[model samples]
Target: MRTSHKMDPVSLTGLGLGVISLTFQLFSGCLKAYNLLADARGMPAQFQYLRIRVRTEQHRLGNWALVANLTEQSGSLSTSLQLNEALVQEVLREQETILTSFWKVSHPHTLMIDDPKPGPVSGTEGEADLQERVPQSKSSLEDRALRFVEKMRRYPSRIRWSTFDRERLETSISQLSALNDAMMSLLDSQQQYKFHQAQIRTSMQVLHLNKKVDHLLQLFQANSMQLSMAQFSQNLRLLHSMQLSAYSSEPQEERQTLATLARFKALNVEINLDSDDERSNTSTGIFEQPPLDPRSCTIFSSVPSSYSPEEVRSDGIYENIPVWIEWKYYEPVLHIGHVDPHTQVRISRLSALLSNPQKPTQFHTPSCIGYFNDVSNYRFGLVFRRPIDVSSVGVPSSLFDLIISNEKPSLSMRVHLAHTLATAVQYLHSTDWLHKAFRSQNVVFFTNPGDTDISTPYLCGFGLSRPAQNTEMTEQPDSIPLYNLYRHPLAHSSIAVDGKSGFKKAFDVYSLGIVLLELALWMPLYRVLGVDDRNLQRSLQPGVTKKVRELLLRESRYLEMVKASAGDVFADVIRACVEGFGEEGESLHDKVVVRLETISI
Candidate 1:
């Protein structure tokens, strides 16, 4: 697929009467010798290095062919290379002779004739004759070479390379390498430089593709293993169902119905006929929160807190307080974080949009009553109406608290939490907003004062949340390293160095990636990095985000832990989020929500 440009042709003349034709014949001989070695089978592992050497030499020869313009249709190179013909011809002949040695070592039973006929001419007819004989001469040489290769192919496969042939093969390669060097030396400096540059570019491209292939292979192998285990379990359940059908004392109809259900379940299918019914929908409503339209939501500004000052409980849950706004009294939980001292206007607008009571009920997040300013502390709080599902619990605990307490959720619970958080993010992005402060601490579970519900994770910590359309607003990086641990490196600066340097959707995805990592490893950010809070807090400087990013990227242990705890599929999703979904074709819903749904305990 690579394109080549025309270059000055080397002159090959006065060395002999028919050296040009002889050089072409020798090139054909080299091609034949390369094929003979390449097609050989039953080569021992000890001499596999020889096979690699053959390939390298073949590539070099091909480059030489391209540089010399020998493969071009115009044949301009052949006409110009009439000066110093004998020296070039001798170098080609020597390379051909060395390559032939490989054939003799591998296929001793086959006989080959080394004969070439080069037609020489004088004066004006010489150039025309050279061009005319180019095709005929090449064909004659190729035919003889193919016949020799065909004979060698017919030899028995039982014969193979041995220790004795090692020295001969290496020596042949070295001699051809020397002759190749000689041939390249005759070319102009520009041609050699261009050839080497092309070779380097080719190598780097091949390396990049090879890494992609290797990663795909690892994914394939991991999936294959999981599929095999799943299939085995399904088979066992099917067998059990068959036994029950054969021996059960129940009625035939009932037994047949049970067997059919078993069969469907074995194939991972649900047979729920009333899946669209209200009852079925309500049962699954907690995970299917509808997305709210920001345009439809009302923004309330300067709604002061109606209650006395209340600090966060020791359990890290805000006390439920009465928030009286717009002539309505509603009791909502306060999820608050510190904000920039100057951005009161932006915070007020975002809270008003989220807390609009007319907005649809958000199951994965609390409905917002309105924004309440804590003037005493200069902190703004987002007042969210208690979720119906969590109404029975006293207060909710953050994921950070649960993780440090060592409350390890079951694999199924963790999977559900991951799915819910991913969906929450997708919904937020789809609704034209960004949860810029997304992290484990922001994710809360509504449960008893001392207990945690890992299954239902609500995304919180929206103090920094903003609309995606508002690109004019700049982001201030969090002072605490713990908060910035989940943020993208590009978003660590308040100053937008470029379009990507500012906070974007990918930054939100990066935060989601880190939260998923917490779910995967069941550890807080500090513990995952094997550091304490004091040490993490000490890293309050420029480029801290990049430093942490580099640490995570370089640490294979985190990925290993994810795979061990959550399996291959979950690890892959985490990788995509952390690294980012490469192209914009797939929405976060497809890349995260849909992929997480496919994963089972």
Candidate 2:
């Protein structure tokens, strides 16, 4: 197919003055061209892949434009683009050239322009106005894009695409893809710069706010404020009494009993606490699910006697952690046990959700089949949809067993393991539940241990998990060095700065870091430090402080091994986790989980 040897100089003026605007204009033009090609009719079914590919490129370009803030008329991207003006401008010009090659026009005069669309025309007005309009308004960009698309489509006859045209189209697509890649790389650099600047500004703002608060407090104290602690307490008590009085003021028939009032007061406290916790926590609301009624749920009173429960034991830690057992029932014929359609529907949906979770790409979690309650205990049974014989080979059910067995997952699987595990923890934290027992032992697989898909790990061991806003007393610290190895240093004492005794999300993050460290090196924590349980115990005798310091040192030293195993990026992610996800008010969701998702390996 004959194509334009040179881009119309008039059309070139459609690219705006700034590099980002110009790049966006060119991208919009390409996206429009791809959409037209993709949506073209009468194409043979054999060439459907080409259409799919063109549509994919169209989507990619469109998404990139949105992400790069190209849709905004006055965006920060314009200012950011100034930093790399020459390179960006060159890329834009190249894109502009490649964009014109989509059509078979050898000359700019091949197509007649009638009522040229009105859009943002950059540069000189006289000759430039004759050029195509670029998108100034978001809608205008799309409109102008369609105009280019229609212009390309208006040939002598409907363009019958053949195998001959495929090569040229593919070439143009590839060139456009390459140019877009370059533009995205530049965009990433700009984004990183902006993010860094934002972080610095946030830090400065926090500092300033802290100083202002401190100054205000000092001034109030110096002025001998009448609102003393005792007076404030008295006033607060008075308000509380007044509120109770108001409640009591209701008609005798309308007023609630003391029991109801007390219950309401307790609920109010919980509501206030939850709200405060949610407001203070950055990780909340990442994952939300509708609550299901326990009464309506399909509860199994009995499980298969043939299927024995598995235990995963960490080598250094002799404690045998009971694996969350799973088994599925196959009854093609309806049992007709219950008549409630809504309950059945809920069960069916639950089964479907468990079997086919709407999970992120390359991320997996073991599906919980249903809840089973024995006389004394209630537990969730997790299952893999496909039945695999675990009995054929003695397979370990958890990461702890897998690691101890000296069988290493492939590099890709290891990377995925780290990522999915981190993500699972993030989701857990996001729901305001802290996985107090997060470790390799808790990271289980539904499949057998011998050849388990490490990529699809499920975070278990929720027996110790608790809500972030819960005021329950923290469990006593386990003196076992094996368990302490996974615990954060502060967690060893079960004391926080606020004098609260509980595992925070930060503690869980530290545990995750240890698990990640073990994954990277393909060794347990005790082995990494060249110390067995006995050695660790002896080291712990000289105060938990010294032992914690040793652990920190080991973590730092083994970081090189992590880098050697997985690249510097993975190592940095590990470091961030171990260091409490950085001092900047960042959460594991932002620092560790999202960062892991970005790692290519």
Candidate 3:
């Protein structure tokens, strides 16, 4: 006991406590990090997803960039870099398949892209807690990008909903997984275009110019993943045809395509006119979808005239409503009209001289079969008339895919789109009309090959609409649906375009700002998804919040990241569009935004 008292027990105790404290701290930190990592990896484990699909010509787009990068490294592909390229391509090919299959599955519907909209960031209170950081899990990294397959609860596609097709959803999931695999595997940069070009011009080559599938196979034989330009275009045309058949396959009188729509109308006529008091002055066989011909209706061009039209056609009425035309290439005399609006001047009734198949003497206007190129909104023409294929616009055609992939329009593109929209607004204001619904899909490019890259897109649908400028902004409060997913956010609080309501140029400009971001992003803002006037009336409801506004404000960090990568000039335009509504209004700009001089088409 005497010897122990002499010993330094206090010092020993202090040392022991310090060691325990340090150990506890280390364990606590590790546990916290592990929890965060686990939280981050909340998605399901076995779900392989597709991000997007893009078909390119490999020889036409080979490792030209990699070749350039190789030259930068040492003027040639070092043995190591070549290995890296090979490895990268292997990975890319694997991923690109994911998107390709996604396209195959969703090629029929544009509403949903594969692997889009990752689940919520924060796990709900009911979910389990993880306390240690997980290493970069292979599954997690693979899901870096989103493909946007729809929610499981909803019908996978319109067709699926109509047919109650259980297999469609399963097919969509499988196709999406395959697309995801493709996307992960395909990794060529834009510079790959050079190799592709080089492959296009081999001093001499024996091309087995047979079927399109053979051409693609030959390209594959050349050790290229990119499709030859001709094959690419041809494939697109084939995909377009498939889309058309989908429409035809849908139930008649379903109002999906014009053929069925005509059948719908014929049925309607039969219903209305087949009565005993049938004084059938009009033809009951109007607008019928026949096997011999396919007809469809879509607003080909958006006119600047606002609510009023210069002329009205048999399709609809206007004093001098500019006709909306849909073209069928096979019957160039005008069987089905093109959705492509030529310019300010839309031409319908091209072949008003053909005899109806059944009526030996009746006339019909058949669209001329040919390639029509536009020269800016200034002009356009049907340049070549080889046997052009007639494909009705498909619901989820590759055209939509192309736009989704290539619609990375620049700031200049946004400016042009915004200004053009402004011009439309100015016209609407002048006409005392309101464009109740303005969106990205509603605005598009007119292809004019001669003058510029693409002609100005016109604004079309004013149906189920409102009036702008010096008019009642809305029809009536009661008439307003409580919630419309497509309604503008401001309508949540603001009244109609009544003088005091302030739906003026500035208001339109505000709306245009949202639209500009929409087109620039090629997606709509999802934050303010109101179900009705009542839900919207609540200001901020259960799932509805104005996230886009906060995004424009830079309050959220992750979105800030998305903004940074998208580009500066483009970001500036977005900021400008979202201006004048923040706490300090830091994003607001005072520039007198230009109006489109005029839409020539």
Candidate lDDT scores, in order, read 0.50, 0.46, 0.29
lDDT at position 337, candidate 2:
41
> What are the per-residue Cα lDDT tens digits for candidate 3 across 473-526?
133211223222223445444454333654433444455666655554554443
Which of the two, 1 or 3, has more TM-score? 1
lDDT of 3: 0.29
- Candidate 1 differs from the real structure by a C-alpha RMSD in angstroms, to one decimal, of 24.9
TM for every model, in the order presented, reads 0.43, 0.43, 0.27
Model 2, total clashes: 2
Range of the 10 consecutive residues with the lowest summed lDDT in candidate 3: 47-56
Could you tell me how far off, in angstroms, the CA of residue 355 lies in candidate 1 after the best superposition?
A: 1.9
Model 1 Cα shift for residue 302 (angstroms): 23
Per-residue C-alpha lDDT of model 1 across residues 177-294, encoded as one tens digit per residue: 4455555555576666545543333222221222111222222221122123444354345324322111112212222322222221111111112133412211211121222332
* Deviation of model 2 at 455, angstroms: 1.8
